[model samples]
Target: MIIAVVDGMGGGIGAQIVSSLRDELPTYIDIYALGTNSIATSAMMKSHANKGATGENAIVTSSRKANIIVAPISAVMPNSMMGEVTCKISEAISDSEALKILLPIMPENISLVGLENKPLSLLIKDTIKVIKKEFNIK
Candidate 1:
């Protein structure tokens, strides 16, 4: 299966997700690291993503082909990631048919009501649980 992990800024979150997925999922599954910048892409690549790409076009294109797209909630918000995520990028991701597994992390100006505000590590664990359930992983 093709799984895309999208991120911007420092890419720390993406790296964590990639690392966890790499450890938990079968090696046959392909992990694509899609980043808004080279720095972010590099960070995720270091976490052992099978492939990595950067910039709007790469992200927009990969989002469509991925079976699953994992990212922060801000990925669907225009001008997010301190402006790294453009309107087109957000639109493409939001419009994709892929199953989206979004972390509850939001931009500073946006707030999610009743969110438990868990740390990133905990959120990532929850993400893995959801993916395993969907894919029927042991």
Candidate 2:
């Protein structure tokens, strides 16, 4: 399956997610690192994503092809990541048919009530658990 891990800014969150997936999931599953900038893309690539792409167009294009999209909650919000996430990027991701596995982590401007503010490492671990459950992987 094609899993797209989207991120922006320093891409630290995306890198952690990719790294955890690489360790837990089978290598045959394709991991696409979709970044809002070159630096973000490079960071995720270092985590061993199967493929990497940068910019709005790359994210928009790959959103259609991905079977699952893993990202921070801010990824679906326009003007997020200190404006790294554009309206088109958010639109393309939100409108995609892929199952979105969004980590409940975002900037101060947005908040999801009732969700605990977990640490980044815990959030990444939770993300992997969700993916494994969805894919029925042990």
Candidate 3:
């Protein structure tokens, strides 16, 4: 399966997701790191993504190939990520058929209704659980 982890700016979140997924999933699963910039992609690549792509076009094109997309909730919000997430990127991610698992990173002014705040590690664990459940792994 192809799991795409998308991030922008410093790529800390993508790096964490890629690292966790790499440690937990079997090697047969492919992890694609999609970043808004080269720095972001490089960070995720260091975490051992099978492949990576950067920039707006790359994000839009590669997103189609992913079976699962892991990213911050800001990825689907245009003009988010301090304006790094362009309209095309937002559109592609939002439009993709992939099962998107977004970290509940409450944006500056927005808030979730009922979702309790959790550390990134816990959220990533939840994401891993879903992946395992999907493939019936253990």
Candidate 4:
């Protein structure tokens, strides 16, 4: 299975997701690091993503093959990530057939209802559960 972890700016979030996925998921699952910039891509690579790409074209192209897309909620919102996420990137992600698992964390300017303010680690653990359930991983 191909899992794409998208992030921008400092790429810290993407790095964390990649690292956790690596630790918690089976090694056979491919992790793709889709970053809005090279810095973000490099950071995620250090976390051991199988492959990495940067910028809008890279994201749009790479997103197609992802069976599941994991990212901050901002990845689907254009002009998000301090304007690092472009309209094309958001459109591609939204249009892809991949099941999306977006973290609720976002800038204070954006608010999502029906989600409690949970610790990031807990949220990440929750995400891991979703993946395990979906893939029926033991």
Candidate 5:
């Protein structure tokens, strides 16, 4: 299956997601890193994503072909600037037929690590469970 992971900058949450997926998911699954910037793409590539692309076109194109799309719930907002994540990217992903795995915590104006209340690892585990169930991964 093709899984697309969207991120804005090259650090924090997005990088962690890429690492977790690379370490936990089977190698058979295709992981696509879709980043708003080159830095984000590089980070995910370091985590071993099968492919990496950046910017608006990359975001739209990857989301269109993915079987699953992963991002934080904050990505839904249009005004995010922490990593240059825009509303257009979020809208395209949301409009796609791909299954979405979204985290619960969304900070108003801070880095992802500063977002209080939710543990990212736990959210990732939960998301993995959903992906496994939906895709019937063993």
Candidate 6:
């Protein structure tokens, strides 16, 4: 399966997701790092994504072709993180037929690490569980 992890400039959350997935499900699945910039892409790629792509075009193309798309819930918002993820990107991903596994944490106006509402680690774990259950990834 092709799983695309999408993120913006500050790639803390995205990197963590890629890392966890690499450690947990290293074989069979293909992870594609889709970032809004080079920094985010590099961070995720370091976590063991098979390939990486950056910028708007890459995001759109990868997301469309992905069997599953992973991102924070904030990615669905148009003005998230000072508009780093524009409406167009969000809409394209959201509107696509691919299944989107979104984390519960929303990066509304605070840094990714600053959020005290929900533990990102748990969210990532839950997201992975859901994906595995849906795809029957034993």
Judged by TM-score, which candidate is best? Answer: 1
Between candidates 2 and 6, name the one with more favorable lDDT: 2
Q: Kindly report which residue stretches of model 5 are placed more than 4 angstroms away from their true locations once superposed.
A: 109-116
Candidate 1 lDDT trough over 10 residues, lowest sum: 129-138
Model 1, which residues run further than 4 Å from truth? none
Best by lDDT: 1
lDDT of each: 0.95, 0.93, 0.94, 0.93, 0.81, 0.84
Q: Model 6, stretches more than 4 Å misplaced?
A: 109-116
Residue pairs whose backbone atoms clash in candidate 5: none
Tens-digit per-residue lDDT, 1-138, candidate 1: 999999999999999999999998999999999999999999999999999999999999999999999999999999999999999999999999999999999888889999898999999999999989998987
User: 1-138, model 5: which lDDT tens digit per residue?
Assistant: 899888875546777887888777889999998888888788888888899999888898888899999887766667564747677787888898999987765666555665456588988887788988888887
lDDT score of model 2?
0.93
Runs in model 4 lying further than 4 Å from the true structure = none
Angstrom error of the Cα, residue 77, model 2: value is: 0.7
For model 3, the stretches where C-alpha displacement exceeds 4 angstroms are none
lDDT of 4 by residue, 1-138 (tens): 999999999899999999999999999999999999999999999999999999999999988999999999999999998899999999999999999999998876978889899987888899899999988987
Error of 3 at 67 (Å): 0.2
Pick by TM-score: 1 or 3, better one: 1
Report RMSD (Å) for each prediction in the order shown. 0.6, 0.9, 0.8, 0.8, 3.4, 3.4
Give the winner by TM-score: 2 or 6.
2
**What is the lDDT, from 0 to 100, of the residue 88 in candidate 4?**
96
The positional error of residue 28 in candidate 6, measured at the CA in angstroms, is 1.7
